[model samples]
Target: MFKDTNQEDYGSTRVEKDSIGEKKIAADSYYGINSIRARENFNISRENVHPELIRSIAVIKQAAAATNYELGLLEEGKKDAILEACSEIINSNVAEELKLDAFQGGAGTSTNMLVNEIAANRALEILGHKKGDYHIIHPNDDLNKGQSTNDVYPTALRIAVLKLLVPLTESVSKLQSALQAKEKEFSSIIKLGRTQLQDAVPITLGQEFSAYAEAVNRDRWRLYKITDRLKKINLGGTAVGTGLNTSHSYIFKIAKQLRNFSGLSLSHSENMIDITQNMDIFVEVSGLLKAAAVNLNKIASDLRLLASGPAGGIGEIRLPAVQAGSSIMPGKVNPVICEMINQLSIEVICCDQAITMAARDGQLELNAFGPLIASKILKSLEMMKNGIDKFVDKCIKGIEVNQDRCQQILDNSLAVITSLVPYIGYDQASILAREVRESDKTLRELIVEKNIFSKSELEEILKIENMTSPGRKK
Candidate 1:
């Protein structure tokens, strides 16, 4: 049964019905009955489907319009109207109006229909017709012709993910470059390296930062590789990946049009059936995201620990005091940026777990959790990108090493005895380290006073360059 309610307060009204029931929509609403039902049924997460995904869906719709028009399957006027409407969505913020839930059910069928209804109603308007006039320009018959949610949804999901990764990769690369610059700038500043939270040996602050840069470099490389994986699409594999209702000729044409429209290296998957049934690619992507998150967490934790105390903790480096550390402790500063990134990484890790489980939960021909997987992966990518940008600007680029503290700790610690084990035997070096620690004497003080080696020899052996690198001592 269809029920019509007065929509005067909302705007001019339109009545639309689907198989399940009917409802009233705002007169100018670009979405129709199916989208309205989705919004009502999946009020789980208030968040909308990602804008990038919505844009990708528009691109797919526009590409389909062009392909169908070229094949003479659709008239010129309908194709032009569909293209114009999809362009409105691609170029404008039209998706904000759809408001389909991010955590919707039905393996993203609701999302696919949301895009279809918007495109159809908007195309109707473009053709100077009213919304819900499906006979003239139907959502399924015209806008989503030759496609299924199974094929279209995942294809759009891959495109949106690929697009989002561009900015993410750039953000990570910027962070890596900043860290590399810090490495070069701090190259001459010596500090004590630690293992298992115990002082181990002498190293330059530059080396520590260089390790971080290298870790990020690996993450950047991984992002590029996974983006290539996302390019293998399933656009032509209608309904269970068998090209059931779609003509054979239009299959590759749709892929071509999509590639041209989206400017991606998109190709139809070799085995569309396998792609339709499995979501392993997303699992691989989630794993990469998890790895990057782990690196960010480790680096942030290191920064927080190193910046822990101006008077109590390691205090090897000073992070920018962007905000007050505490309300009660006067003059207290916190590593808030690092802590924020640390927490963001934990969230990303949890998102990876969600994605992994969603990917694994697919039934015979489709996964009912595609929307959840897509939403979580995209959210993780966006969160990581934003977190990294802030971390670089607010923390990494503003970090300043406590040079005197580094040198003082380096000179006083018995860990510098590691450098001496090469010249002196390990047994002698161990004895000297124990004596230096028990007597509370600096390594240089004890060495010089005991005449362990000449001042020139000590200077050469203890040089940071020699200790940090594998080369003969000067």
Candidate 2:
């Protein structure tokens, strides 16, 4: 119905008909009727489903085909054709053929159909048949035998997410190691610590960086452990978590084949209905992602504040200047890398919110929101991995502590009074602090003027090592 007389409009069009009607698709295109309808119906995201997701679905089809052939359901020639087609998809970079929007309705029905159609047509070509000649290797009858979209979509997403998490954990570990290196680098540089944004006490910059490193270490562990929860899949559940047309043997044997194909220790869901109906595991994973984002955001904000200025602001640490910050301000550089991390964290947090809400809004038997959840979760994982790597390379590794600035600020600030309070008493120290703040004199000048302690005694009390340690330096 959407076709024009000019066949060149669709680049040599072929008529592919579905129950809804028929439309003209590219003659040489692997995608068929369902894909054409989806392209016309859903152009929301305008971005293709991720390549990993497509490849993951191909693995599912390949494994399913092998299982079916073993069970005496699929013929040998059809199985071989499907295997070769799926293998080419996994190894080659022909993701363009599976052109469906990542974010769409029907709970990934269109995506499942797109994959089925592409695989079926590819298998047809392998068996010396033209596209749309699905009579030989039908999309649903052969390629999707004993499977449903509800089962296939979530299984593919789990596989893709598991593959995605490997690099994410590695990037987080690298970020933690980078922070640890900085912690050791700044271990001896004592700086003024702030509580509620006011001068409170003295602490080494190393201690602060240690806190960051420990936070990131926790994030790494959290991301690493969540794979177990994702390993359980409702693949054989069919329509409503009942085996439906699928045999019990097929239900049990598919997991082994899938594990072999994907190289993951995947297991079948104990309660397929629950796994299919309730999507809480994804929400749990998103919660951990939110935590990781929170940590990255906090660290990035602190780095930007610490690297505020070379002349004004805190100026305690210098970040690597990677670009010109402003057009009008001369010789100015901003914390672009840290800001990038902050922005990425914000987006990850937003993606998590969408995932949580979509998961919660699932209907009676199906979520109908798998597309949203999958896209957000996968995007969050990918961006976090990329952002953390960039942050480690451009910012954390290049950070240089301003030892002179730290010493100068501590020399003039009132935080050092905490160090002297033990010997001078809290009342005397409070009085000295108040007087120094009110008057123009520095803490050192006031202490020397009042003879609170002798000059040598004050110097000894205010030593960087002594001030930063506790309980009389052990």
Candidate 3:
């Protein structure tokens, strides 16, 4: 067992050479020379490329193989091997083994080459050849036939982003549903609404939650709109969008094949050059994601404040306690999930800034920062999704209303006097508001004591449901 372990660790290394130099590789590594050099050179970020992107690259390679076979550029056996290898990468959990950093230069050449080498070597193994025996199925010449890093990298990035959007959109929908359910549940529960951190008017707790649901629904719609924009890819625009060594037939057919394979409504960009150089679409998507983050932060902050205290703060709502909030306090429970969402939103907003800068820094022909852009946006989407799911399940669904507290606050607020303005003159309402605030009398008490109207009439006018909507203008 010791000898076998030694062989697995040391004796399994094989030599593979490239233009720069040669390096010893693990015998069973799907990646070849370029990937090994990239791993050594790009020691930045220490994180593996996102697995969604890995799957996206494999999906593209599989589509390319099918297109190449249809165009008679690849033999059926070679195409079969490539397709099988891509399926293996997609279906298996092999992403951690790729080892390419998400921060690299060369307009994503290292990433594209990394995927190419993995697919090529895996195909070679499928054909009963050793990993570096690329003479039988060369990574560049055959596996990456008619494609370039410039084209393939952005195309795969779009596919990966689009793929993630499906789940992210679903998560947002779930959040909206959760908020909507709370709205319906709390619809009749009256609470004091505020502006400028001061009391303003009476509103149903349901209306507040309804607004949150609507905001999330709008975000879901925006996500769908951006997904349509991401479907336009520059797949056939090799090296510089001139389709240099690739034929028009291959260019057009690749899109069709990719659409078929990915089940996405994909199309080739009409101006491949523009697609290759301009990353504005990614920036637009990031901006929309930031908008959702803003909404999330606002909602989370509101929940934290509403759940702030049972004794000191605006203890209008109770959030479900998932864990002990304080280490030292005897009976302390905290709004931890809301705080987590707040921090996640901040992180997403920061990631959007990084993506915006990377998109802006692209020079002519290619952006060397594609990897950075992909990493930021993917991380933002995934983090937001996970955060949203947990928030909905643990926090939103279990929230309980403090009904008596809400009524006590509402009865004491002077802002509810606005509901009396239509019944009384504005001047009278103002004086009454000042008198009520200065004395030890509540709004309901003063109205009853003064006999401003009959008790039943005042009760009818100050009804919570009547105050929530428009009444006769005076």
Quantify all predictions' global Cα lDDT against the true fold. 0.87, 0.87, 0.87
Q: Is candidate 1 or candidate 2 better by TM-score?
A: 2
Judge candidate 3 at residue 378 and give its lDDT: 90
Cα error, candidate 3, residue 5 (Å): 13
List clashing residue pairs in candidate 2: none
lDDT of 3 by residue, 1-474 (tens): 001112236557888888777778777777678876777788877676888888888888888999999989999999999998888777776654556788887878888888788888878888989878878999998878989989999999999899899899999999999999999999999999999889999999999999999999999999998887899999999988889988889999999999987889899998999889989898999999999999999999999998888889899999999999888997899999999999999999999999999999999988888988999999898998999999999999999999999998887777668888877889999999888879998878888889898888877877777788876433
Clashing pairs in 3: none
Q: List runs of model 1 lying over 4 Å from the truth.
A: 1-12, 444-456
Looking at model 1, which ten-residue stretch has the lowest summed lDDT?
1-10
Cα lDDT of candidate 1 equals 0.87
Task: Put the candidates in TM-score order, highest first.
Answer: 2, 3, 1
Number of colliding residue pairs in model 1: 0
lDDT of 2 at 376: 91
Candidate 3 deviant stretches above 4 angstroms: 1-9, 444-456
Candidate 2, position 425, lDDT: 89
Residue 196 miss distance in model 2 (angstroms): 2.1
lDDT of 1 by residue, 1-474 (tens): 012222455667778877877788887667688877777788887788998888899899999999999999999999999888888888877665557789888888888888888888878887889878889999999988999999988999899889889999999999999999999999998889999999887788999999999999999999998887889988889889999888767888998999899999999988898888888898898899899999999999999998878888889899998988789999998889999999999999999999999988899999889999988988998999999999999999999989988878776677667878777889998888788768877788789998989898888887766777777663
lDDT of 2: 0.87
